[model samples]
Target chain A: MTTPRRRSQQDLSVHKRQVENLQRRLLLKEMLSLGALGMLAGCDLQDGDAVDKVLWTMSRWNDRVQAKLFSRTRLAPTYEASRITRPFPFNAFYPEYDAPDIDGAAFRLQLSGKIDDKRAWTLADLRALPQSGQITRHICIEGWSAIGEWRGVAFRTFLERIGADMTARYVGFKCADKYYSSLDMETAMHPQTLLALDFGADPLPAEYGFPLKLRVPTKLGFKNPKHIAEIFVTNDYPGGYWEDQGYNWFSGV
Target chain B: MPVHPLPIRVFHWLNAFAMTCMATSGWAIYNASPLFGFTFPAWATLGGWLGGAVAWHFAAMWLLAGNGLFYLAYGLASGHFRRRFLPLSPSGIMTDLLAALKFRLPHEAGTYNAVQRLLYILVLLLGVLAVASGLAIWKPVQLWWLSAAFGDFATARYVHFLAMAGIVGFVAVHLILVVLVPRSLLPMLTGRHSSSHEVSS
Candidate 1:
């Protein structure tokens, strides 16, 4: 009986050691994976072929993901006359069109990736869509707040017109003003959000994403892309300019 | 000699100074963008004035953090720190605390009296929490790892604000104690308190 009991105790000890070893290995594996991701993110610093290919690959994947996701969601909601807010705050940096390259006729918004029809939509084409309006609060990450009335077309309707594929998962926007931003499909389709053309019944001010901009009410103002030039739908996560610099990609209020 | 030595006198005073600045500047910032219904309008900065308050607060934070790191390193190397202040048995601490509360100093009170020991430890821990939460709310992106400790950006802000309030309360009490016992203040200021020795003698 003593021999049997001793043998069982030793077996239990061995089992405990095995479990501990496996746990340690799992933790190390996770750490290694994070290190790899960080390395990939930092790889942009080194120049030439390998880096360019990786960025291009990532950008292509990002475009496909964006379209599929936004189609599933609805556009920003419109507000009634009574709900219209006064003194709409415009917090974007003044004189937004610093880049000399933004000419209205020459400025074409390219819509491609994960679509049956890849086409360039002139400014007039976007204006033809059914428009929406909403009065919502713009929350800044810097602990400031403002309210504005925005007018834009339903982003979902735009996706539908383009015949976005089911495989696409996100709505990635590339701004003409060198501003790069992206959003998940769920947020892109939120009923209170918009791809705004007008602010408070007026054309979008240059400082506040003039010509075209995004309005995601539930998120901090930084997530709202301004001066949109390209709309690509993608199945993978697209990196935002701020996100690459360590800002919260979610930016949820 | 301790594995973790007591912080340098300059560091102690500088830390105290920076903490005071942060408390005052933080209050200024809070008055402008108040989360609570409560408002301190008199303390509120008008318009861009709040921006200056933020700058000063952040500058003071850098000073406090730099000094704190130096102190931590010194303590770890010098063997000055133990599990508890006063280095007495728990029962002894209880008795000493009771005596100090009653304004009756115990005969066996160490470098830090029972009251001083508890307050000091609390202040140290609160300082750490304040820094962590500040980083969380300030550059949540740059310091994402720190934000993880406090949950999210807004939640981290709440914790940071609460910790600042605690530090402010502690400062008020600390000031009152200093006034009540000038001898204690003298030691902190001059590093050799004549009055403290007189009392012990």
Candidate 2:
């Protein structure tokens, strides 16, 4: 009995020492991470410059990983009509009052780059195309979500109709509101993606990307460029408004 | 008295650092497109801009998840969960709460009182909820089942926000208690405490 008690005391002491050693190691690691954070803090670099380059590099790496994992066939879930957020909020770089006023009769979607057809498209021409609609959630990067009904031509159909180079790596959009964005060919061809011309049952309202919007349900809200003016397919990267401002270029869901 | 085991101490600090980064960066991200009407000031948040905040948030998210997993595995494998957090009686917890409300510290040195155990368990559960809801929001389409479980994307965001609020509350209480009894931090820092020290029961 005495020998067993002595052995237990020795084992406890050994265990306590091991715990102390681990705690010390952890403390050291904690200090090291703190140092790294302090360095990051000290840099205090502006967006799109210096230290931000590292972050952008990391963002690009993340984009590659996401793109690699992206499945073309997988669709964003559609919601029921009852689930649609009433008064679907108008969100933009500008205020709702500042929504662009584009004339439907005069509005034309310009086409360019790596396409057989270079002719501009009038609103009527787009309306003549087969129409499709979906009620889907718009997930914002800022941590809020809203469901909205978007009605438009399937972007894949439009892309095919225009004789775009299906082999191209990117499909870039220039919006009338100066908010340009681009998508990977895979995302652009996603079945759920649309060239939205209407909101709910009405012709697309001025406050909701009048004339046309890219309704990309598989992406975060900012990636869905509104009030599209021009679309071009290219192998070269076409930077976007927010992407240039340091948001991730591939803001996929 | 037994001190915190090595794995527990390591995971604890790692989680603390990750959670701090997550909360601060999350605030910055939230300010970009606020859920409520108001926004957090730029100075108050860790990241200066929406993009910067997102970078920080993602980086810390990985750390939080990894550390949390390590903690969970260690707790379960070492029987720490059963010994320290379970077998909690409501009567004992109520007594500890009353004592706490009366400004009497109910804990003895190197041992948790019922109230501390319950709060710790609650915070642990909240952390799990935060991570789950975060995943639902982060990958709603890929993790469609999780999103559906939370009702929808908007509901998941709400739950995530609520979990964050709960964690913040726990942190505030924890910090206050640490200030009130600075010695409580020693075992966490050094993995040892004077066994002889005790509070009157």
Candidate 3:
């Protein structure tokens, strides 16, 4: 058999491809090495997205794409009467100055925002509407938690009475102590939400947002803004006191 | 004259430095919360700021891993790895291992012997485990697959914490060994392992 004098075109093409493949692999390795060093040197800085923002973005996208199997009722488990222990760690606006005592004449709920009808309603008016009560856990971001039964007019009913504008996206709770909180429209209208007035069958203590406080079951303790000064319904994402301080406004438990 | 290749020496000590930083910061983070039976006291403060702790730990991790990768790759490509690790036969390895345990070494013993080989391998392997487990705990969702390897999220956190304990133990022993053999420590620092003839041997 005669020895091959020269490589065929096909053989040359195959050899060329192999060389290209090897070159690509080598290039990739070099890039990875450079990338690792780049991280070490703290290069490749970009702006406009913090780590928490990234997490929230991811969470929102995840929620939209993959609906989590959250319990629909949104009710917290109630403990036995005997189990109710000393001083359930109270939170939010307390001890209203305007109305030290239960003065129905003085207490008036003011509501204003994106609405054709913007006005105040009395506690009698709220009580006249359909009411709801549920035992729910008050989860604090500081890592402590408590469970309490809240009784009041359903937020959905209140929203209807106030003629909440269809375009409104957030409900900003203007509180007594200059403390403000905002809730997303979806959470604001959630079935378990309430404009709470009673704690465990007793009238809410002045320290625990007497007369009226927003009871949003799914939120952390901070989001339930107390001693409601006024309720401002807005069509924009309203940044709250906590949100300005780098805490997420939507403190969903 | 060669001074143990600049990157290799730098990477070596840099790894040791980063390892110590991680251990110290990790101790602080662990003491911040009590989970499982690993209860550290409330007073022990290795890092005063949680944010700083997180930043430094992540920064050190990147540096340690990068240096380790480069060193390993360079050594293997340059045939230094084979010279350092691969050539010894099992019989020679066993003999050297026994000699090391007994604090004995014959003439012409290599820079690293059999027991050193095992310990070196373990150190690298444990470093890798530390990084993997750390990532699993740090970003459970980001590196969910890694976390899944050690079971659920909490379990992975526990494992990562335990792995840091392992690293601390290794470092303690490593320091003791260096103190016992000042000659070995000198080479590591000065990048020169003088011949036995130069010593009192």
Candidate 4:
């Protein structure tokens, strides 16, 4: 009797949260669609010949193709420290000055969906996890690429520790910068995928996602989300910020 | 005699359409962070922006690759490449090149001259290089050896760009030749040789 009551209560809150999220997103899309950036990324709006729909369908189809092409044994090349790009470029949807500043002591990584633990983790807890470092290139969707060093917990290990449903279809991230992204299960489980906590020899600078950043060297730069505040594992498709636009969903590089 | 056979004409037109889509969108993508000092003009590009360009580029990639592969298989299996493009010697090419410079080289229907054969072979090789280099840039991690073969990631981009440039040059010369010999377009369009075509090897 108690268990049924508890489930009903949870369901009600979840439904309410969904409605609120929808309203927020509606407002955001409307505001964004008013600008020149909208013209560049205007798939959500009506288009001549429904060109946007065709492109989006093709992008989704490419996602499946890339998934088939991905091999578990394939590893993104690692460079020597000397080859690491000097003055590594900083990239974000917003300008550099607008990068969020959060208090480290108050930070907590919220976890939900398919996670057995369902408990938030602090910076200290994250630091205590087994860690590794890598020097790898970050290939952007545009055209340029950069190499950098990052040290953090392997994402598979982190997911295992959190008791994530390993078979889940997607691992989604909600970033403090209002940026969000999702990954296919295979990519999420890649050995090199990291919940990066440090950049170079320093703790991650706020500008580079001080608390956490998803470092996926095998994917395009936008796939590696920064300033992560929440993580969820789900079977549902979690569309990304750029992905909801015209960019391909599986932007593997 | 058929100058351009039905299957060959089909493949040719399909390749032309696919190449146009890929090249125009690729130019738009190149504009985002151009490897060179300049970018393609807005009018020359297909997509309105980087994201749009990328979507078109990847989508058209399938058409180009599929049509090109079919074309290659058919060309080899039918012995078309052997019959039309064989006996290509450097001296023959030089002879044709010098004659062509004086505007006296013959355009024999149903036969490829040494210079024309050399250009076709070079362009075919460029097509393969462009696709391979494109895959390298698209998936440098999974296709690591491919990019490495070209020297690196950046080198792959360079190779892709050069291959595209070569194909564009070929297209320009091809169009000019068709304009000069207006009768040439008929064979491609109708897949038949109306003139008393020279079918000799």
Query: Total clashing residue pairs per candidate?
Result: 27, 0, 1, 0
Interface RMSD of each: 18.7, 4.9, 13.1, 17.3
A156-232 per-residue lDDT for model 1 (tens digits): 67777888764466778888767787877666666666778888778786767778888886566778888898988
DockQ of 2: 0.22
Worst 10 residues of 4 chain B by lDDT: B192-201
Q: Which candidate comes out best when scored by lDDT?
A: 4
> Which residue pairs in model 4 clash with each other?
none
Q: What are the lDDT scores of the predictions, listed in order?
A: 0.63, 0.83, 0.62, 0.86
In candidate 3, residue B136 scores what lDDT?
Answer: 59
Tens-digit lDDT track for model 4 on A1-253?
8999999889867875664465455445434643433244343213644767777778789999999999876899999999999889888888889999988899999999999998999999999999899999998888899999999999999999999999999999999999999999999999999999999988899888888999999899999999999999999999899887768888987
Docking quality (DockQ) of candidate 1: 0.03
For residues B1-201, could you state the per-residue lDDT of candidate 3 as single tens digits? 333656667877788666755765566556545455674542333334443333345446666777888888988898767777765667877888777666675333235666666666677677778878866554333344676688734576677767777767777777676445434444444565433332211
Worst 10 residues of 1 chain A by lDDT: A37-46
* C-alpha TM-scores of all predictions: 0.49, 0.82, 0.49, 0.88
Better of 1 and 2 by TM-score: 2
Give the DockQ-based CAPRI class for model 4: incorrect
In angstroms, the error of model 2 at B56 is 1.9
